[model samples]
Target: MAQITKAGLTFPIMNSGNRHGEVSGEPLPILMRYWRARRNPRDIPALPQTVRRATGLTQQDVAYLAGVSVRWYRQLENGVAADYSADLLDRVATALDLSPAERATLYLRAVGRPPTPYSPLQEDTAECWDQDLLQLFVDNQEPMPSYATDLSWNVVAHNLTLRRWFPWAAHGANLMRWVFLEPEARQHLVNWESDWARPFLGQLRYERAHHPANAALAQLERAILAGSQDARELWHRREVVEHSHGAVRRLRLPYHQGQEVTVRMVTVRPLRTVALCVNLLVECANPGGPSAS
Candidate 1:
């Protein structure tokens, strides 16, 4: 029997049962390094080569687009495991116009973890809604109390009934901002902190987490945190709700003697326009009494 020292640990070598081999004129009962380990033979390869080549963008171009320094982005491309945040990696993925698979590979290799689900490139919040979509909701004869919002929670399309319920949406407004920052929302929505704002905050947090590179969503979060003290405090709570679909909320109906009504919020997304959310409100319970406010 033979022994070897490696990294301060003694490793026992194979005994005479080992097949005979001689090297450097060593004896036939060869002293084999018993604790030998196999290692990855190939070096870490450069990442984003396919994406960068396909986009025909240099490292500087990508760094400029991703809002990162060229040196940092170059290290990222060289497959260096730096302390890059998910947000920055997301930005790089967007800059390279990486496909979902490419982005997954990039994230897995760089960060040792898969990224959040694929998000389509965030569009400008000011983009016009399709005329058909507007007509189907805002101008349609459908009596249902419905409203539509873009990813930024802007009330892009809404009917008279929804406007009647939420007067601010009558024109156009960011719904989450209204929920979090508006004085009127605080007054009308029952349990503003627990019932209304908390879930909305959770939804906001959820969206922002999944779509780290969405500039519009990021701006919306910043605005919410700046304007609402309660939102700022509650934003750190460990909760994340994707949406409030099918949840019943109590609210004082607009211009209806401030009638307290429980409405079930039904949220639906358009297949063609995946970023649009159409929310329909069904009055589930209407306790006839003076408003809670």
Candidate 2:
């Protein structure tokens, strides 16, 4: 008699004294069976259903909730080897009503354990960061300003050079907030209107449009609109910035006697989470500003 989860399986899951963090077979078969059982809820246990169709989600329902196509979700349930993003998996787990332990197990099976040890007590929405990969970028970009941002444009990870270049980054998280509301930003960023604020404000607007339901982003937008009269006026311009890659901008670095320097922004997305962005600022040798002093 095979069980999806064996009896007496405690936290820090082990397979009958096997090595810690080791998993047997793939994880989706269990989910596939779970989905099947949901269609016939009597097979598992009794549960009240408002609608007569079923108690839990159908494949289409899961696809809708997780923002995937039903065909894709069907393949996933059928144990297809697909490179799904962490965010997508979490969304599916939420739709599946998976416990923290089950979520952790699924993650373990899909991507192996994250750089950080698996924590079964984590919340359903929690994401597992590849700390080593984040650290690798930070370490490799020594003396060069590079940082990673989440969906909210918050500086989730950064290198020493980033902190050195913009001291505000040391404590002032939420890069969007800094760009919009921080006084220090206007001082450091050259041409506070055309060069800095317009582009960033456009990006904020674009993100809000893309993720209208995101409360954090909505709150950030409201705060920016309330805090800066400039933001309000520019936001009405109705511009949208899709991406900033290869975009040249000018700023006053903390060092070099606060000299105006030209930098180009290059953006990359990690495989673990496509929504997260990593930006590396490369300074141009020739400062192309009007007063390239």
Candidate 3:
């Protein structure tokens, strides 16, 4: 019998008669050696055990929650089944209460690739704002850097003050993408780990959970995951947090001449509507200070 060991799991390969059909010859041994040479190890965790441990659920419980028979679920866990359909895997993911990262892992293990990202259904009642309303909002936020973003953090509009400050907060710029993918962001953000990366990613996770099927958001996530190793690591952590308001962040501006500026970030929703629009404002921490620039 031939065997393949990979990722801490061992798979036994069935042996049939040698193709050369020479018993007591070099052909059989050579074929076995060739099979052995093909074996490669991977670093992925064992899927069954990972799901079991993470969800803290029994096999029976998972089967029940997934709306599948216990025997089928057992076969899945034991890796005896040939393959599971994507829909079945999705059901199992829900049953296990998996996070987005965990669900991605499950799909990778079962299908040898991540599941296709879902695109949310478009609603007919999307809110509409006139240019005057938007302009008025921007005009009122003077001296302070302020911008408006849609639910997915796409900067729909911004004041000149914001452009003067970040320069990267251009129309259609995604806040998450800018923070995670832009090299300039790393230089400008003093506390990238705690102040910007964690909270921003946490808020992203929260939004993703709420709008998992948004195609544009999914594409942006894919881009971010591909662009930055730090973003990938933080994303897999699956830390979900509510959006923070009035948070203070330290920044190193190009014009600040080696002085770190402390700015208070304020996040607000212009209308009390889900997935409508949000506004971000940055103000100086110290009143009447040069940092306000």
For lDDT, the strongest prediction is 2
Clashing pairs in 3: 119-213, 120-213
Of 1 and 2, which scores higher on lDDT? 2
TM-scores for candidates 1 onward, in order: 0.54, 0.55, 0.54
Model 3: worst 10 consecutive residues (lDDT sum): 39-48
Global CA lDDT computed for model 3:
0.61
- Better structure of 1 and 3 per lDDT: 1
* Candidate 3 off by > 4 Å: 1-124, 280-282, 286-293
Residue clash pairs of candidate 1? none
- On a 0 to 1 TM-score scale, where does candidate 2 land against the true structure? 0.55
Q: Write the per-residue lDDT of candidate 1 for residues 166-266, one digit (tens) a residue.
A: 77886668899788766788778887888788888888888778777786687567556644567878988957888888777787756668877777788
Model 3 C-alpha lDDT per residue in residues 142-189, reported as the tens digit of each score: 877777776677777788878877777765577887888677898888
lDDT of 1 at 53: 40
RMSD to native for every prediction? 20.2, 15.2, 13.2
